[model samples]
Target: MKKLFTPFMLGSYRLTHRVVMPPLTRMRAGTDGVASPLAATYYSQRATEGGLIIAEASQISQQGQGYPHTPGIYTQNQIAGWKIVTEAVKSQGAIFFLQLWHVGRISHSSFQKDGALPVAPSAIQPAGNAFTSTGQRVSFETPRALELNEIQQIVDDYRRAAENAKQAGFHGIEIHAANGYLLQQFLEDKTNHRNDRYGGSIENRARLLFEVLDAVLEVWPNDRVGVRLSPFNDVGDISDSDPLELYTHVIKVLSARGIGYLHLIEPQVRSGLVEDMNHEAPPSVATLFRPHFSGPLIVSGGFDADTTEQALAAGTADLVAFGRAFIANPDLPKRLELGAPLNVPDKSTIYGGAERGYTDYPRIDEIGVNTSE
Candidate 1:
């Protein structure tokens, strides 16, 4: 636990602690996908000098959006909106990275342009429900297979979004290649059934990710960029027949590219394990891939102060990302250091809400408890 507070050099910046705030999507953006000023306050409240905060996933383009009010980086208004957020976080001496995202098949027609089918590596319908723009939960529709030309367009959009992120004053950028999004759809065998250059073998399946990385690199240096991958997440009904082989290749390539770090989500930490778990936790993907990756690794999934210290001490993870914990405790690092009582998060107001649950959580100093009670 003591080591978690020690400063370490990550790329060119020295992070004050290893506790990171991972991207947690709070759908409070406007209908036009512009970030609200509340987004600024939300991030600033949790800001720590020399810590890292990966902002919520922002769609690369209108076609890439899967939910309503999820911010986008493709427009001027969105960029201006993000400028406010980045400025607010930076003023507090925290570094913020924008997660570039595209929700490939985990979407419905209601969010699509002109009722066009959502695009993916194949025309398969994932087994899940998507929150439509109208706030209705509808079954995911079978996404249309992305044409080769369309794929190039999406890549271009990512490239442009990277530039926009830079203009918006972000310290770095994170490529969102996990969670069954567009990049993951192209990486996994079950979702990616295309026989084109972007499918088939592991190399081909991972082609889109590397291509997107290449585009992203045109604007930002390799060391100023990071990539997040979830090899064990099945949230979007995403599965890879050969996750090890696929991720190993992807990690090696990204390492060679000199990216700042690799963010991996551990399986034990997903949202629904308690109710559905039949046995002990599975092997951590971080431990499995640690030797394969030469860069910094940030692992996320239910982690306490003890587990986080253990992972850092064992050299399995460079940092620990806290999502749910950070939701209820804006001063998470401080609270962890003091071993103070934390505010339990309210699940109901996690998404698409106001300050009721977003920024209303009381900090330790503000918790007015009667010590004599």
Candidate 2:
């Protein structure tokens, strides 16, 4: 508990605490892929002085978008829309970073321009549904395999988006290489089946990721860039035949590059005893990769206040990212410090909604009680 409250230097910035607000996709943007005006209020409410808030994932291009009402950083209007949100968060003294995203095969043709199929490293169709631009869930479409030239174009798009993020006044940028997106699609053997320079071997498969990072570095320095990876989590039906070997090499390369931080998504721990687990739970991602990376490590998934403190104290994780808790409790750091009860998030209104479950969550003092008996 004491360690959670202490200040620590994350890259060049000194954060007041270890509690971070990870990027959560709340589909509240406009039809033009502009951020909602309410985003300012929503983010500012959760911000604390010297805290870190990675803004929601914004697509680098129209082809990069996978869902409706999710913001983009490609257009000028989108960049201006995000500027408002960043200004609001900065006003509260929070360091803000925008998560640059590209959903790749996790998208439908409807989300693409002129009904073009979604692009990926390979044309394999994921097993699941995809949200259409109109909010209808349809079967996942088999994405088109990107040509070698197209791969370079997408990398350039990431570089342009990084420049847009800089124009939007973000303190830094986090590449959304996790969640089985385009970057993860290239990294995982199950998704990437190409035999060209961008696939086959692990080094070839990881080529696009490093290229994108290198392109992004041209705009922002390595110390201001962060990369998110989910080595074990299979959010987008993503998997690798050899995750340990692949991520070990990836982390070592990133550590050598001296990036801001490595944000890792821990595997979801199911309820029950260790033996009663549905599958063999691998060791904690933070513990296994902690020694490999030298920079700050932020771990996200299924962490409560106690577990967060324990991770920090044990030195496995430098920072713990809270997604749902920050959604329901605007003043999460303050509430944790006081040991106060947290507001439960409404499940139904988690996405594509107004301010009901978005900005309506009350702070501790705003939660009135009938004490005048």
Candidate 3:
């Protein structure tokens, strides 16, 4: 467990500890998809010196959005808004990576530009609900299948978003291909039924991801870029007939590319969410697939300190990311180091809210509580 707090070099930047803050969308951005001032305060409070913070999923284009008030990276206002966020995180000496996102079939026309249907690899309706403008969760609608030309445009959006992240002062960028988002929709066999060059075979399913990566690499070096994947994530109507073969190939391809790191949401969220909603079952160890990739592997889901210790000790994960834990404890790393008590997060205020639960979670010192006796 102590080993996790030890400094490690990730590409050019050296992280102080392996306790990473994975991207968590707070839906606090403005209606224009511009990050608000509160967003800056929210992130800066959690920033730690030499730590890594992957910012919340930000839509790469207006068409990329699926939820209300989620931030975007395409417009000038959006870029300018993010500048404040990146500068705030960097000022505290933490490295910030913007998670570029596109929600594909996981959206409704209410969130789409010009009321057009959401686009996806196939005209499939994901079995899930999306947050709408009225703050209501509505069922997902069937998406429009993307043409070859339109696919190219989406890749360009990713490229331009990466460039915009650089302009906004982000140290690096993370491509969100996980959790049944746009890229994952294209990767999974169930959602992607296209007969084009981007579908059918395993190689074809992964084509769009690589194309977007290639475009992103043009803006940043391979070492400054990373991709997030969920080999067994069932959310957003995602599934693969042969996950092991599919993911092994994907990992091998990424390993060869020598990208900085690979962030994976372990399979814990599958059957684990039902038993104990508070405890996310630890993701199945990916040690079996470790040999397929040589770059850093960061595993995230529901991980306690002991589990984090075991994962690092067993060499299953290089870094452990905490989402809900970080939300409740702004000084998470410090609390862990001191073995301090954590603040229980208010589930109600997690999504669209102000400081009530966003930045009001008190640190140990602020409340004068010490659990590390």
Candidate 4:
């Protein structure tokens, strides 16, 4: 457990610990893609030492947006707004990174320019509901297939977003290639059916993702940048013919680029092996890239304190990220250090639930018990 607080280099910045605040979609921004005051306060409270905080996914450009009030990095107003956030986090001894994102067909026409259907690799539509501008939940529309030349424009958007993020006072940027978004749309065979150089074979399917990474890397040195990949366990109607093979090929290619670290969201960790013997945990795509990647790896999704400590001890992953737990317990590291019980989060407030389930989650001390910070 003491090793979790040890300092290490995650690319260019020397992090005080391996505990990372993974990019969770906290839908608390203004319509113009600006961080709200609540968002600022929400992050400020969780600010602490030896932890690297990656802000929620923000759109690279207006066309990159899908969810309502998810924030953006394309405009001055947006950058200025995020500067308030990064500055606040840094002031309290926490380093912050902006997660650059593009939702692709995961968006609705009601959210696009002149109600245009969102653009994706092909005309395939994802099965999901998107939050509309009016805060209404709407279904996603089939996206327009992107032309070859048009792809370059999107790649350029990532580069410009990286530049904007740096100017916005963020310490670094994380390319949101995970969780069934634009990059995921292209990486998965079911979503990408193009026959051009950007499609077909693994290299072709991985072309756009690599190109976007190339564009962003042009602005951000490999050290100051990181990329997240979710190769298996499809959520958001995202799946490939062979997810493991596709991700290994992709990781083998991207890992060589020397980005900060490849964050892997792994299978659910068991609690006392559960009584259900028929049910087993799923496997992670990390095993495929384990031999391919040489940099530090951060693991996320469905992890508890014990599993996290165990993973680090077994060297399966260098870092562990807690999502729901982090949201409920601002003093997560401290609580874990003390082996204290955690505050169970109310599922209702997971998104757009206001302060009740958002920032109001009490620390261990708020319940009449105290833990040193």
Residue range 270-313, candidate 4, lDDT tens digits: 21101111122246545556787888888887777666767777
Candidate 3, superposed: residue stretches over 4 Å from native: 270-285, 371-373
Model 2 per-residue lDDT at 276: 17
Q: How does each model score on lDDT?
A: 0.87, 0.90, 0.87, 0.79
Give me the runs in candidate 1 sitting further than 4 Å from their true place.
271-281, 368-373
Q: Residue 81 lDDT in model 2?
A: 98
Weakest 10 consecutive residues, lDDT, candidate 3? 271-280
TM of each candidate vs. truth: 0.96, 0.96, 0.95, 0.92
Tens digit of per-residue lDDT, candidate 1, span 80-140: 9999999999999998999999998876788788988899999999886876888888878
Backbone clash numbers for all candidates listed = 1, 0, 0, 0
Candidate 2, residues 1-373, lDDT tens digits: the string is 4788899898889999988999989999999999999999999999999999999999999999999899999999999999999999999999999999999998899999899999999999997789899999889999999998888899999999999999999999999998889999999999999999999999999899999999999999887999999887677778898999999999999999999999998876431101112144466888899999999999997898788888998899999898888989999998887777889989788788999999999887787633233
lDDT of 3 by residue, 1-373 (tens): 4988998889999999999999998888999999989988899999999999999999998889888878999999999999998889999999999999998887778888789999999998877576666678777788899998889999999999999999999999999998888999999899999999999999999999999999999999998999998887677767888888898999999999999999988766532112212123223736657788899999888789998998999888899999988988999999988888788889888888788899889988889886658
Question: In model 2, which runs have C-alpha deviations exceeding 4 angstroms?
Answer: 269-278, 368-373
Which residue pairs in candidate 2 collide?
none
